[model samples]
Target chain A: MTSRERAEGPGDGIPGRAEGTGDGTPGRGERADAGVPERGERADVGVPGRAPVIERRLHPVTPLRRAWAPLAVLAGWAVHDPNAAQEQLARLTDTMLLLGIAVLVPAAGLYGFLSWWFTHYAVTDTELRIRTGLLFRRTAHIRLERVQAVDVSRPLLARVAGVAKLRIDVVGTDDKDELAFLSEREARALRAELLARAAGFAPETAREVGEAPAHVLLRVPPRELARSLVLTGATWGSLCAALVVPTLLWLFTENVWTVLVTALPLLGTAGASSVGRFVTEFDWTVSESPDGLRIDRGLLDRAHETVPPGRVQTVRIVEPLLWRWRGWVRVELDVAGSDNSVLVPVAPRAVAEAVLARVLPGASVPAGLSPVPRRARWCVPVWWRGHRLAVTGPVFAARSGLLCRRLSLVPHAKVQSVRLTQGPWERRWGLADVHVDTGAGKTVTARLRDAGEAGRLLAEQAERSRTGRRDAPPDRWMTAR
Target chain B: METGSLDGTGAPADQPVWRRLEPGLLRVRRLLLAVWAGVFAVAAGLLPGLFAGPAWAACALLPLVCAATCWRLLERNWRSWRYAERADDLLISRGVLWREETVVPYGRMQLVEVTSGPLERRFGLATVQLHTAAAATDATIPGLDPAEAERLRDRLTELGEARSAGL
Candidate 1:
């Protein structure tokens, strides 16, 4: 059977009618009064104030094609034993059984090939229409206005072929599936068209950086990448193993091809990891675009993701121990309705601090808020006390900064959970660590060079944790419960 | 644990008595878990053997392993598990090595579902699951008396409805 039939037909459990509209026709509800313009007639003209919902043709993966794969596998298996001519002749002895599989092999293949051939998509001034089917034909209709976020990802193979996949996620619609697997050119065009539609076509008003813009933030350089390779344990170990082990193995076999296949993915992984470190170390940038903030990273993919600032629910800044010496911090933002967190892998101390300031301006901890005062506290675990710490008179503090260091303020309103940690090594050095998590997942962590102050801080924060709310109250509204 | 008398005021006349866990039941649960673990280890070791080498003894061990995994997961900390209604939330604390404490505040609870699997039904026990907006954050307090589970469910539902109406 055809993929559309499989997608829409009885067994799949998805009902016949499409997403929003009750009937097979596209326009229903208030959309009927929307006065959707006819295709190609002054394509830009619709309701004067609002952007027109351009209906474009989108093609989805065919079920016929998905089902054809198994048949192709069986066919390939049957003819795979080329050296055994007698066996091949004997394979035909089971003619009745073979006929059933062989007939499906060609029939399904022809159907899949024909379905792909006929699939066509076009975005008109009014709506997006995708029509594909072999026998039981169907169309997928999506109103351009409802689209929420557009994500584009290209595998290495797709990159070589100059083809990328596009996914258009829409809000308040149960279409069961979004747009996927479009060629790179087609994907870019779709993104641009939808973004333009969302922005409502005020040409000069469009943000310089947005979902449609190709401008990127982080790019990796070579020298920094090599340094990062030596620093990263995983990368360093693999490279050393690659150089030494292969030389020993080469004595057994002169063949270089066997060594190459095994070495390439590992070398590529180490190089990619080193490049990631380079991007994190140097040329880190996050800039405000008209639509949202554009985050760019990677040496290869050179990805650009636009996060609408309004959607941001929480901001997190993390400084793990290894990264502290290099003065690097990772920043992550949590947005509403999304399960995934958006992150900037590596930012210089100043850039990370600035980004945190913009995203979480309320994260200023009052100096006197803590009952016990401590000088420059390091946000390290107690087990990691070999790191430096600073103390001023009565207060115990540990200070660590990869580059530029800033203290995180978890206003009483934001505090969620407070935890204290210590290990055998920490006990030996008289050090203790304290971590206070806010409702936004932002943590104000301090590893005291002196154990006494870390204990006091942990005790004080635990008392505050009882009243921490889901959202940080405004500074003006901060109240002690 | 002491049962407190209710007063006309919100607070009870007397606080409920809290006791240390009964040691004998705790030991029994630990013994059961140990057996379950032993079964699981044997099963995991045999799974790869099924695909590569067909040993009848290893194949025979599969069912026992599956049963042990399910049994251990169901009643890992049977006796030490406790549920107490604090000022705001219902707290569930259990487990031995990796202890867990989950607080289901009345306002955040979406629904309270009390379910009984066959083994639970045979034991006359019920589990109340408090679903929240986030799937991962939901809490299930297992092995409660049937009547108590129903009462807790009623209280949670009433509070949830009141909170939804901005009370």
Candidate 2:
């Protein structure tokens, strides 16, 4: 069966596969039965089983997709410097120009083609092995059980070419393995299979796991996204600097050109960044599937990110000063191994809370957090009142920032370490600060507590973390179920 | 020195028995400081002497005085450094004026490294660095006997593996 599929061939010259392998091929005979056959049979449906050894190269359009960036850059440079282009063209004869194009274009294409040809990925029962590199010859074997998350991202060029890239993030590793330029449907299928395998599912049920029905939880409209972006502190700060600084300069120097020159770039940068956020976060949707939370976002470069169960390290709910009036807040999750961590770009307070509840069950931002000691006001006079913290049964939460209120939550099971620090001034005031760290960079810090209270909290939190880990579900969540 | 015992626990097991860094660390530190002080004193005296007169060579006294002050400060700082091995976690306390106490659980340890630089090796000293998933965790116990450092690494690694929990 594997040889037959191999003979069927890859890079079929079609930019994308229409439909060779849809679903429901019981290739379970070759499956290595690790365990849990009962649950596998119950859950397995419409899943295309994997052969004993499945190996294939990336799509044919990968070369073209890879070449698009440099070609576009060259075109942009030529357009920007028309005089330079014309001068260079005039110096060369027609034959020389043709020869140059012939040599350069093929050379670039050949390089892309060779790199693509050398890249081969294979999936066995236990691991996904990728072999690439033309000269050095490197091979990466990622254990299926260690797969953390699989992301399918389509940049503008790849989207146009009807292909996508699959980025595989594994446990305890910073580097991501990527399979560049697969047909969109194939990428989705592969992602599902990999995630299922990671979750300890049999090969017969892996494909169906990807097709599990998802319920839409929240969707941010384009209008709300625009309004939220405009209200952000960065936008306001940039606007004020662009307008106020230049106006002051004009008043002092009385030069209109200088003001224009100074303000243009600042205004351009601010406007560009805001628009970039808008483009990236457009049509942001959060949906809950059996596998995990599915975040499908972006306009120009669509990305489908799956945050598997038990992977969220911390959740942050931020309400900017201006956003408070509109009752809008942004919810961000510190998901392990994923950079696009914004769970919801903008939502109402209640909606954001609801989404948080979905992401981290039995967790919420508690009301009436214990405020810092009054004497600690010497450190941060204005924001000390807002620096509050609470320890719930499931999570430890800290609230800070008077101008922009932020509530950071870390699950007890996710606490990596605890720290209690006291500066000279804080010690003088008989106060200390407590920090609860997670795998992600964000930490929940309870600042300016009584030193004794801080010590007790540290000990209690360590105990809680121990119990939490003892009771926490295993990495293979499906098997536990 | 037992400033922050949790819950005022009376049990000796509950109370952390803090251990101080090796006394040899102070000697190594003083030697390192002396070398730096000599280099700075020479630069101060020679640079000004080249531009001005030999009278400016008195500036050499400035680094010596500063080094003297730091010599006392280094002892206090070194004395301030201490660590305790608890049931589930390790507690490291340091800093003279601004005290910091870090609690890292065995389950959270990702890597533990034992390293000895040339000077440290010359003095037969090593440092044990503990790493967790959190990058903010700066847990280092400097200036231990080389044999002790290895033992700590092995014991920590064993505990970490036994209690390993995913992030």
DockQ of each candidate's interface versus the true one?
A: 0.08, 0.32
Docking tier of model 1: it is incorrect
Which digits, one per residue and each the tens of the lDDT, describe model 1 over residues A240-320? Answer: 777666676567676796677666776776665665556433443465544445554444443434444233434555565
After best superposition, candidate 2 residue A181: deviation in angstroms?
1.3
lDDT of candidate 2 over A263-331, digit per residue (tens) = 899888777668888999999999998778899999999999887778789998998999999999999
Q: Taking the true A–B contacts (Cα pairs closer than 8 Å), what share appears in each candidate?
A: 0.00, 0.46
How many steric overlaps are in each model, in order? 20, 0
Candidate 1 residue lDDT tens string, B1-167: 22222323466532322222333343444556667766775666566666667554465466566656655654555644666564444556565433444444444454567886665655566667775433444367766666766776776665554432110
Using TM-score, give the best candidate's number: 2
Error of 2 at A103 (Å): 1.0
Candidate 2: list runs displaced more than 4 Å. Answer: A1-51, A72-90, A171-176, A208-210, A240-265, B1-13
